[model samples]
Every structure is written in structure tokens, then in C-alpha cells.
Target: MRATILMYHMIDTPVTPAEVRFCRTRENFRKDMQLIREAGYHVISLKTLLTAIKNNTHIPDNAIVITFDDGLACNYENALPILQEFGYSASFFVVTSKISGFNDFSWDYGFSCRRMLSTSEIIAMAQAGMDIGSHTVNHVILGKAKTQIAIHEIRDSKAMLEDALGHEIPHFAYPFGSWNPTVRDVVMTAGYTGACSTMPWPNRPDTDPYLLRRSEIKGQDAPWQFRLKLHFATNTMPPITEMRQLTRKFLEKTGVISLRKF
Candidate 1:
């Protein structure tokens, strides 16, 4: 069976004329969940899915791993109930600094309400059956940072998550799919066993655990487009990775300062 892990952001009922990008309106989310259920798929946590993959444990024919990044309040308020309604679970990768629920993240539009889960909220979610993972301290794009900064972001974030969750948070997601050979080494050194990426790659076997590929659910993809992506999405790895390196080199050559994957 092929292991498929799906990434999602917020699941709120989109406010009229949705202003956010990369987030799903509540109606779409409902449709998605309904579609998954109707398709006979089981939505499971990252650990459950990955353990099965790493250990060759068997999974039902239609099992799928569901995940949410950015630790939005909507996750607790909106996404959780839907998953629970369907008896499913998900893994949440939260940026630590924003946990105060004070709107810390300023970059993206969903960030218009970007706030990390409060320690209390995270504890609540954990208690309510959600696996917690780290996005990083400040959501820095590690691949472009200096080596020392990159090391801090990678190592320190993992430690922070372990401290907050009071257990191992061996899984990770680069602040922005920002990955490279050096970044991978730092992540491993930081004690992460498996990490996900924002890159578009296949979820079939023999993937690099340190750079696991994931499908991003941008707000723009229609359900049919999503189906198209799953069937036709680029799953190639070696050449794609080489191309990433070449792009980095070009950025360096031009000092364009690309922080794309991070």
C-alpha cells in the first residue's frame, strides 16, 4: 500500500470572500472530510502512519495521514471538532514563539490571525488526542540562515517542543520546506527522527525521512484539482533535489536571497 500524508492549514468556515490564502474554508474542509470518509479512507496521526511505514507494519488499504501546520487557533476551535466528529486524529506543528496567542507571526496572510497554541491550549489539544510537533522558534527559513543560526533554529526548536509536550517530538517540518544537505545534518544532529517538507513530492516508499515530501493544500486547489495532483503530482526525487541545489546556487550567484523552502 502507498503511504500518503496530507498537509492542511486552517479549517475555519472561510469568511465571505475569503481573504486568506493557503487555508481552506470550513465548507471545503467539510467537503474534504466527507470526501475522505466517503472514499473509505482513515485519517490518522503522523506517528501512526510513519511507524507503520518504518517498521513495515500493515495499514488498511485506504489509510491516510493528516497534518496541520502553523498551530492556528482555528485548529483547536474548528479543525479539532471535525476530526473528532469523524473519529480521526492529526499532528500539529506549532511555532513556539507564537504560543502566547498574541498574533506573533507577521508574514503570511492566514497570519492575519496567526497565533500559536497557548501552553494551555497545546496541553488541551494533547489531552484531546493530538500529536504535537515543532515548526521552529520563530518560523525562520533555516536553509538561508547562517550555519550557527540554522543550528540554533533546528536544535533549539526540537528541544523546546520536547519540553512543552513533556515527551519526544521526533517529527519535524522545516519552517518552510527550507532544506539542503547541511540543514538535514543539523536536523538529525538535533535528534529528530523524521521530518516533513513543504515540497511537492510523492509519498511512496524510499523517501528521505529527513526530507519527507508532502502535498500542500493551497486555498486555490479545487477538489478535482486535488485529485489531479494525487494522480499526476511530480514524485521524482533525485533530479528535483539537484534542481533545488542549482536554484540555490543561482540565488547565491545573484544575491537574490531566496528563502523558498525554509
Candidate 2:
């Protein structure tokens, strides 16, 4: 009944050095989807997972949920096509204030400013059966903000997104994966059925819906590394795994092994 929730950001080439960690090439995204299919995993929506958590019912052990944060234009321009080709459903968490605008706030974190998804694109995705969730009004870091600011961000973002899509926005992702217990309570009071966090682990029936753990899929991961994360629901390697990777790197660096072999 354990399920892994995979987190992704932009689906395009890195716009800056800071973006390299967050961006995944479209080709790689396709390959990742293909790998998921070949691995016999079932892709489920966030809503389905939340329902299962609520009902305390059993879900497939191989169930995985795909989610994209920030609602970048590439999500519609690139990722959507691949996801549709695979007939997979994903949840998109968007910043309410950035629809149809540039992500100027990214500059504050030293990330390259990129275009956010347009309202039209978001509505189209929702129409196409993608779950549209709320990230926040301004991507405020709820855990660090004042109580009133957190309340405003949590409640207002949901209201704004619902108004846009003409439907309930029942899920949310903590901005910057930042949330304390108070922030969690705010989200609960704001009417979110579930919330996503940056913690890397699989969710179980006993796991808190508001503190749902997600394993981030980074652009730097190799195909094998991606498989490991998918199966293990974590990127943190154990001691033996770390030693093996180090040994492999040393051998490759010393010319005892060829990159082609890997």
C-alpha cells in the first residue's frame, strides 16, 4: 500500500546555472515516462492517493503519483504532450499570482526568470483531466512567514485558483517545501484535503496527508539512478550503495573502466 509521489519542476533546458538542478530535458522526461511504464508501475493522480489515504484502503504497491510545481510554461508546452502520449494523469500546483506572467520572484532566489503558465493553458490542462492544485498566491514560504501572512497565502490562493478553474482546489504544495505545524493547521483550515512536502519517502495509510512526502526528480539523475528512486522512494543512498558509487567513479576516473560500459 506504499505509494511514491514524484516531484518535478520545469520540463526544459536549464535557463541558468541555478536552474540546472531543477530543469529536466523533454527527452529525459519522455524516457522517464517510458521507464515508468516498462517498470510496471501505475501512475495515479494526487486526488486518488488522497482518497485512498482517507478511506484507509489498499492501493497497488507499485503506485506512483506525478506532480509538477510552479506551473512553468514548459509544463504545458513540453511536459503535457509527453504525459498525454503516455495517457498518464498528473497534478500541477501553480502560484496564483503568476498566471500568464513571468516568474519574477525566481530572481529573488537567484534562479533565472522564466515564463509561467498562462490562464488559458492551465484551464486547458484542467479540462484535459489534470488536477490543478494551489502552490500559493506568491509562493510564500509559509513556515517562515507571520501567522496572518500564512493564513492569507493559504486561504486566498485556494480561492483564487478555484475561481480560475471553476472547481474546487483540494490539494496544495508547501511553497519552497516549507511548513511548520502551524502552517499545516492553516492549510487544513483553508480546506485542503492534502499537502505535499519535500521529504523523500513513500506515503503509507498512516502518513499525514498534510505532510505527504515526495522524492524530487532532479535533472542530474541517470536512468539507473531514476529507477532506484522510483523503487526506493528516496535518493539518499545507504552506506553500501554510496561505497559502490564511489568505487565505480574511481574506476571510471582511473581509466580502468569505460563510460560506454555503464
Candidate 3:
């Protein structure tokens, strides 16, 4: 079975210059959902996707999984109804530390100030059938932190989410799509069933469940660009990400940049 995972962030208007990449206008988001339907894709939850991968079962040829990062309130206010309108399920990865407060990303990324989903909103969405996954306690990039720090970020966030929701969080998405061998090992030790990455490609049964490939759906993408990305070419090049990783590593070694800046 082959499946594609789509990654998203804020689903609201771009009020600031930096939010242009992360915030998809409500009208465009609705249109994207419609486009998915018109393209004949079956939207599946993260649990179902992992189950099919584990069991090596046959899934629909056009299967796709939708996911949102940061657990922004707009997901509950703007995205959920559109998802429900089309009968689709999505996975929401929440930053445990940022819930019920303004997202801390604005200072670094130039995003407009916005509040994240409160605990009650998250619970309601989970009860309503959205998968709640962890994006770590403070949105720390695990690949750059010290071993102990990364482990704490991984395990503590999972424990926090499970404790609050009274259920296990079976999935995770590495912050900034940054991870290394050690980070993956810590994620496994933390007991998540699977993790998603920013890598752009569809997953087959043979693909590593821990490093599940995903395509980012940016606000700037047109409907046609979204369609091209699903095909694994012509819109965003995954290899360029690889090059950027190499550059980052080189800069870190030369002391030209700090890993924390990533």
C-alpha cells in the first residue's frame, strides 16, 4: 500500500510577512480539501496509515493523510469544519508548552501573534476523531540538543500529553523536521508508534515507519502546485533539503552558526 502524508500549519489569514508561508487563507484551505476530493484521494488518519504499514495490508491507491503542526486555535476554528464537511480525519501535533498561549514562533519566523488551542479544544478535537500527536513540550529541535535534553523533550512531551488527555499519544513529528540517528532512537524509546518528517515522498510498506515521508502544503502553493507535490516532483525538491542539512552541519562544525538556530 502506498500513502502520501500532507503537512500543514496555521490555517488562517497571513496577517504578517512571515506567516505567508505557514498560514493558508481559509478560502484556499477549503479549496485544497475540495481539490483532494476531486483528485480521488482517500483521507486517512495517522493511526490507520501506520496500521496499514505495519500489517502490510492493501490500502486505497489514492490514500492520503492530513496533518497539522503547532495545534493552533485556527485548526479548531477554521480547519476542523472544512475537514468534517468532506468527511476527512487529520492528525494534530501539539506543542505542549504553547497550548492556551501565544505561539513563540513569531519572534524567529516573523509570524503574526496568535493563540494556540486550549486543552479543552484539543480534547474536543480528539474526541471528535482527530489524532493528537506531540510536537514536543517547547518545540525544541531534537537533532541539535544534547542527548539528555533531547530525551527529556521527547519523553516529557509524550507523558504530558498522555497525562492530560488520559490516552496514549502514539505519534510524533520532529520539530522543524530536524532529527538524527540519536533523535530517532530517543523517539522510539519514548514509545511512539511512528513519526513523520518533512521529507517529500509517498510511503510504501517497506518505508521506515519512524521516518515517514511528508510533503509540506505551504500557503503560497497554488492548487496545481499542490497537485504536483503529490506526484513527488515539480513543486518542491526534497534533495534541496538534504543539501541544506549538509550546509547546516558544516556551519555548526566551523562555528559559523549554532545548531540551536535551526
What overall lDDT goes with each candidate model? 0.73, 0.92, 0.87
lDDT, candidate 2, 75-133, per-residue tens: 99999999999999999999989999998978876788789999999999999999999
**Model 3 alpha-carbon miss at residue 225, Å:** 0.8
What RMSD, rounded to one decimal, does every model reach? Answer: 10.3, 5.8, 9.9
Off-target runs (Cα >4 Å) in candidate 1 are: 13-19, 108-113, 229-262
Considering lDDT, where higher is better, how would the candidates rank from best to worst? 2, 3, 1
lDDT of 1 by residue, 1-262 (tens): 4556678877764443333555787777777778777767666667766676678777765566778887888888888888888888888988877886654555443445455568888888888888888887778878888889888877787788788879888888887678788988888888887888877755555667777777776565677655544443432323446767887888877878655542
Task: Look at candidate 1 and give me any clashing residue pairs.
Answer: 12-26, 13-26, 176-261, 176-262, 177-261, 178-261, 178-262
Q: Which stretches of candidate 3 lie over 4 Å from their true place?
A: 233-262
The TM-score measured for candidate 1 stands at 0.80
Order of models, best TM-score first: 2, 3, 1
Find the candidate with the highest lDDT and give its number.
Answer: 2
Q: Cα lDDT for residue 65, model 1?
A: 73
